[model samples]
Target: MKILGLIVEYNPFHNGHLYHLEKSIKETNATHTIAIMSGNFLQRGEPALFDKYTRAYAAVKNGVDLVIELPTMFACQSAEIFSHGAIATLNSLNCVDSICFGSEEGDVNILKTISEILVDEPNEFKIYLKKYLDDGMLFPTARSLALFDYINKYNLLDISKEKLLDILNSSNNILGLEYIKSILKLKSNIKPYTITRVQSQYNSETIESNICSATAIRKQLKDFTNIDSISSVVPCNTFNTLKDKINNNFDPMFDDNYFEILSSIIVRDINILNTYFEVNEGIENKIYQSIFTSSSLDDLKESIKSKRYTMTKVKRTLNNILLGITKYDMNNIKNIDSIPYIRILAFNDKGREIIKNIKNNSDVNIINKFSNISFSKDDKIFKTLIDYDIKASNIYNLIYYKNNRNLLKGPMDFYISPKYVK
Candidate 1:
């Protein structure tokens, strides 16, 4: 039985996502699809529009066979760490045969080439990169210039520098390439595949196509009460789900309240801001200055923005601060060879069989409930952090209604018939 693995943060399950899921399975001839998804917070350092459980349920209802939560640490990090963590989780399953991701340039060779270059940074390239950084250019711009210089030095013209620069700008494709690098780094046998993204640009904020970017859809949802505006863009089921949620006055998991808490945490711990993940070269001092002056998350981000640190990077730093994840914890987690355990989020009949097979052949524990599991000291610390995240999510839920005030606990089972099977 072939199994296809996907790394996703279906902040909200939309039509484009459903299309990717179906096409990936068809192209790979896989019997089952497994997803390592972001929990409450996503890579952008923002809270997921929906909670992880709801998103998992939505995936199961659409087409996915099984879903596992990506630890908050990796889910909230940069592209490289995010890819590394997702790949590590899927590899630990010991059943995933291939990993599929969406890319603008669907050519596997180009992605592989980029991955190799990044993995083995040449001395000349490093020198150039350092020179550009020293000149006060941001890291992304410096890296792009360095890569362009490398291309010119090698007399390589088959791939345009403009094209390569575009790839570097595209965060998703860059991460997709990182996933390939990680597989090679681990000597894993998982094959790589890419599905060309359609209609929606990853970073676009306008809903122009039927397949709209999550950012555009989310922005619309904040101001409009009707789902009809995005009806053509999202899956019917997802549309209906959002409608019901709105009617019930249920706010998305990541709400303004969550950001407020994040802001408060940053302000209160201004002295220890550098202790969080990715805080370097006096970034913490900048954050302290911003927190005291800025009123909202967006304002704080703008106040602290610099040429070297992007908005996304600042948001991720805020996430670490809110979760109390220190620099030492980040180092420790990065060294983990495999996921500590598989905490099942949702599974169907085929997924159940997969779990049975895992138990028969693997030594990794499969956990379905919080009470059934005991954590080591390190694991306990991680769990406590996760619980804090959950509380943050619940606090956002409170914005909708007083009755919707409780922290979610344990793994949730969301059973639904697969479209193909049904």
Candidate 2:
């Protein structure tokens, strides 16, 4: 009954991921492992290297017992919301015992302390936070400085501002803190665990042996004159999956002209740009003007970015617009605790057992077939979230068509059934 939960992207399963999985299992001494993973889009506001199903299957086959999906709307979001969505989904399951994540700051106590501070949001902390924010510092920078000052002022736990800044600088540690914060905010029973990331730096763009970052792996794939080159990093099944994909002309999908597609949609009404998530503060005009000269995604991002707007924000905003997820929609739906249903992506025997346990205990519907869904079109809240996922799937197919040389057999989401591995 000790079911360990994990939140992951697993963009394409690799040795680093495998090691984390093993370590989590060993540390927890858990009988089952469940992962809630991102769909086609990732938290970084980019498409995954492979589709969700492929990555999920890769996870279940390797070490994870089961894999569910974090829907597209939350998948392409800021770190905090992304963590919130995932943790909420796990909470809904009512069976996960503990959650484990990779972190540069491997101490769960340290991350948990940071999470508690964030959740409490002391008045002094708020004062410094607003002070830095009003001074025009980015939210992350402001929050980091505020927390550092607040902690140092109290002289709590002998933690220095320099050490706290070092913790904030590492992306994995930041994400780990968010996960802990979400658990505390929800007051959930799930315990948090951290596995120290071994060799790969968070979001590093270089590949070194098997333990390179996913960012590095994607970068390697981009420079992959030979598709087989990645075999050293990913497992045999993953290597073969990637091999067939590449050989059949669907290899390098992450690189494409999403800018034109996004622009074509954005140009329809510049004023409507503010409607999408992250398209705030009168940034619509900048986007509309940028679309005309921007020949690529990078070009458009560079054009739209300002001191206030990071490239990740620009990319995510454009992605939200293209996918038809609006700021209005998110604002209305952000408080939802129960995501209407759970979509199972892949499972093994151990995973199947957990599914049975979930069905008997949780109220959330479990969907294995798209046709079996039972929501009314009039339910704008449910429709907006679910439709975004479906649309994102279809749009990824379009991206595939643009990236690949030949015709696709079909989009995996459309044709592939939920994978059940014995």
Each model's RMSD to truth, in Å? 3.9, 2.4
Give candidate 2 misplaced runs (Cα > 4 Å).
127-142, 153-155, 375-380, 401-414
Whole-model lDDT, model 1: 0.75
lDDT of 2 by residue, 330-358 (tens): 88776666576788999999988999999
Assess candidate 2 and give its TM-score to the true structure.
0.93
Per-model TM-score on C-alpha atoms? 0.87, 0.93
C-alpha positional error of residue 255 in candidate 1 after TM-score superposition, expressed in Å: 5.2
The worst-scoring run of ten residues by lDDT in candidate 1 lies at 413-422
For model 2, state the Cα shift of residue 1 in Å.
2.0
Highest lDDT scorer: 2
Candidate 2 clashing pairs, residues 3+ apart or interchain: none
In order, how many clashes per candidate? 0, 0
lDDT, residue 326, model 2 = 85
lDDT scores of the candidates, listed in order: 0.75, 0.82
